[model samples]
Target: MSESITVAGVSVDTRHWIGGRRVASAGTFTDHSPIDGSAVGEIARGGPDEAEAAVGAARDAFPGWAATPRAERARILHAVADGVEKRTEELAIVETTDNGALLRSHRRGVMPRVAHNFRFFADWLLRLDHEDFETRGHTNHVSWDPAGPCVLITPWNAPLMLATWKVAPALAAGNTVVLKPAEWSPLTASLLADIAAEAGLPAGVLNVVQGYGSEIGDALTSHPDVRRISFTGSVPTARRIAASAAANLTPLSLELGGKSPLLVFADADLDLAVDLAVEQYDNAGQVCLAATRLLVEEPVVEEFTRRFTEKASALRQGDPRDEGTDIGPTIHPRQLEKIDGFVQRALAAGARAVIGGHRKDGQYYAPTLLTDVAQDSEIVQEEVFGPVLTLQTFTGEDEAVRLADDTRFGLAATVATGDRERAERVTARLVAGTVWVNCFFVRDLQAPFGGSRQSGVGREGGTWSFDFYCDLKNTVTAPEGWDQDHG
Candidate 1:
């Protein structure tokens, strides 16, 4: 059910899928399941040479692939969606084993979204439009052209879903891709790449290279031949990748970090608000858009805190694969320790822990909730990337907007209020790219998804992804005798 692969016949160790083949290589790294801290398998450790080969394969495939009719490309995407559907169970198992995501979440949430992205982009390909402009005497046309050989760098948090957001559109727009999966969760990436090959994608159109970011990611980001780069990761890494991409002036799209806020008004559906807030922090707060900060109106702060803390305390934390577990371990031991330190520092700075805080082991930390944290504290200001929520109270709507916009990251914000006017006003003022009213984490494939400010640049999902993967060109022309006619 689980295996590695080698693309382009470059044999390597671990379970690496490369160029439509399963590869075993000498250099490998052990992959552990965060659920129980057990070894799942080893992943091939690709180096510069392998990365170059993968990129080269993409380059070689770009001309023919991009020349294919758009309808044909859409057919391929439809087939990909079908393959993913057929393997939903297998993919879900690998996803949970690799990243500690809940099996139900993968089956019910991630997979459906991934399939939707493919289907949505497939429709976009069929209806792609070009604009015609009539100058005084000549006709000008604007066309979107595929950027050749895209380098897709996906994160470990939601590997398959995030990769599909990029891969679906890039392929739909006729660009070949070389994907570098996060070193922490390479299994699903490898598996998905193999599935794409099996879905009848021509050799070299999609390639997966496995290794650490410093080695494989850096090589892919800086490679001169890679025409575009789409990356999803931390803000610092986004900056570095942007700098490297500057060498050739290659186009880049980034989906970086966030410290999103969830504002609860006095009139909000309190029960619903509390439930959504707790669910947002379910994945140990490893999600980029997790509502880690709760800004409640002063009048209802006490009641909201009571309900929120009670729900937070009731959350079950343990092995990710267990049916009863509501929260799982952090992706890595280092992340666990880092989150623990952040909570400790908040406590030292006069914050009150209303619920879980301490770590059970090196990998698992309780779903933590802290109140009375200073606005400037690291726990509130920086992205903890853990399941830690800090509560703050504001006096009025204006103050709520100000406090929510205070952060450097503007990825997402949620407002819980039944008043339509107030919701609209608060939503408009929030600096985040995505604003949710009375709901949280609900995304449609047809909607543009990305962040503002330090959260990220450019966008993904919907038609926006197709625009990001392609370049626009304008052509002005006349009839065969138009030059003389114009003169």
Candidate 2:
């Protein structure tokens, strides 16, 4: 039961999950394992033609699916949750193998988070209110309507979890979706489609098109029939999508890249701070919220680095599927090269490599830390998206906030200080959308998640996502004695 499932009974080619069936297309793309650089699977590389088909499918199903009651949609989503629960182990295995994340994290952390997203949005559907009111001597009411067919583009890092964030809410809001998963990690997306189909979702409500970004992604974003576009990936890509959506003025929500930071004050708990530093770099620091820059107060810089390096050095890095592995290889060989270049550039600019500064095999890069990195260096200026963290020290709260805010990205940040007043003050000054006080990556289902500046344009998660996927329509009713003709 854990074997690879094929589309159209063909092997060695790309496949698409459309209308509850695994259908193969003429175009194909190769998918590789980041750890060993071996071919794991192939996905049907869709192009303009396939994009049209997928969009058409979603459009065809839109009216009926959007007309379905919220309660019925909730039942379908709950069934998806149940189906995911049934194949939890298999999904986890495929996810780890395909995405190069630790198996334990996928099974315990990400999987549960996906389930929680579904359940949370399911409940949100029941609680949504289209309330009536009186305003200016006139009866008024508000209604929320689905934006019809949505084009959802998910990234590779947390494919299923991120997809769930979009899919759950969009479905709950009564929208049909055409999901274009990142080509690098299509296994879990395919598997997720299977699970949803098994859960008895109506045909054409959800479709997965696997392909390169240029082909399928471009077509989907610019498609005339798509009412909205929801994307989670790089800022550059998000910008491109925005421009494309502008062609038709289609509504869009983007959760793009991040160059997040962590600030540790002199009075903070050094051990806890060190733990968080390591945790931020978990999964090779590929996360959008990873604290790539550690700004420590001058007095505690030495001790913090000592503890942080000790913890970073102890992280077990090897096969992602291994139960004992804490970190895994970068998701692609090109990603490793890019990270290496950043480290090399930082080193050339007079930064010191505190722990790891090299690469191994095809895509395996050790958990790395850098010290004395110049504020203007590429490592600090751009998002590394690897297992690398740069260290810098600040003399005071003002300087710390200045250094943290001195970036194009304002995604997430962490401040560790025992002084409540100081923490509040620093949090206010930090430009990031999500600021963690003395903690990192601890997210709640109900919390609004997104970033400021170049990090992203709109928010995901919370009730806000429902608002993002749907449009607001206000209605006004005349009083019983009101006469339109006389007026």
Candidate 3:
């Protein structure tokens, strides 16, 4: 093992995990802290060769892993979860340092959820009982089997947490995996590989490949041995991955970007509605499901904007390591620039910035709220993926639903109303995979999570994940002359 090196107040290992061992890449790249321009650490950059090796390793391990007893698999996954819980603080620090997310949120929310995801999948899989259905003179046997060597490519926004969302279920379903962590945020992923090893995962079962998406992502997706691909990222990148996976006709489950809408009706509880709107600024609004487009009923538009903007403007922004900081700098300078560009374009298009409308040094963009933004404007239609909220008003429920579903992206949505019937009806009309009523971003481990239309193609979490990672196989046996009778 390479000696751990401290970078940007956290320790990181730059080596890539391949074939159950820490391997050095042929090239190296420097990681910069989004908190400042300082260097975070050096990371080994892997390419097509590394992707091939990782896939080969996974393919080599598949038979043994798949054949391993389900109880044993559950045990290892539980151990993995324990490992994560034990190192929660360290992992949270690494995540915040690498991804520029608030350390408080990482510790309180992301880390615990990461651990929960592993444990949930571990226990859930152990409880899944395969059954054989009886029929007249025939027995139909059904079972879930590993999808063979699989590739998981995670996004940078919530590195370790999202990594587990895919990794735990894939491993639990008995598939060997090659995980390609986003180049922008690889620290926690490298740490995760170590945690899995400590939990006694078999050699060549899970591999972590590090490098830019441009360098190794395509190779991993298109590798011949890879039977399935699970990716969480932007729509454009998802499209690219979808196309590459087509070479082998690989099965894919994508949880892509979102331009989620948060609708606040006149009948809604004002305090709760404002709270949900303010929550959008979390993680500097980089969350895929953050309420980027906020629609308010015309009667309550002014009051809602007042409360929401006040809360948004008061958000504390500083170093993620600071406990009191509510917002942190974006992941990189490029992301910061993109966010600034979105706000600027909105302003030029006649949108009025009610709170923040500017940027600072070292990848810091303020939590901004804008109004009078045209429904078809760039900021409203596109996923800003930043701390910029655009407000619009609807005269009635029908217009509100229409305005909410106006976008091509339908990943997640929210509706707040005191009337339960109205809430249910409005949520149903909104075309999103996950719709929140009187709440925002409250995820259930067992509930399906993903998007629709351009937002994404499939779901993750709980059974949806198991279904994605495992292929269902059915067998039928005919007794005596049953086949003749059936024919």
User: What tens digits encode model 3's per-residue C-alpha lDDT throughout 428-486?
Assistant: 78899989899887888889988899988888777778888889888888877545566
Name the runs in model 3 displaced over 4 angstroms.
1-4, 8-10, 479-487
Q: Which sections of candidate 2 miss by over 4 Å? A: 1-14, 481-487
Ranking by TM-score: 3, 2, 1
Q: Which ten residues in a row have the lowest lDDT in candidate 2?
A: 1-10
The RMSD of every model to the true structure, in order and in angstroms, is: 3.6, 3.2, 2.8
Candidate 1 TM-score, true structure as reference: 0.94
Ranked by lDDT from best down, the candidates are 3, 2, 1
Clashing pairs in 2: 14-43, 14-44, 15-44
The sequence of per-residue lDDT tens digits that candidate 1 reaches over residues 274-331 is 9988987777789999999999999888888889888888888777767788888889
lDDT of 3: 0.88
The estimated TM-scores of all candidates read: 0.94, 0.95, 0.96
Residue 260 C-alpha lDDT in model 3: 88
Instruction: Report the C-alpha lDDT of model 2 over 408-476, residue by residue, as the tens digit.
Output: 999999999999999999999999879999888888867888889988877877678888888878889
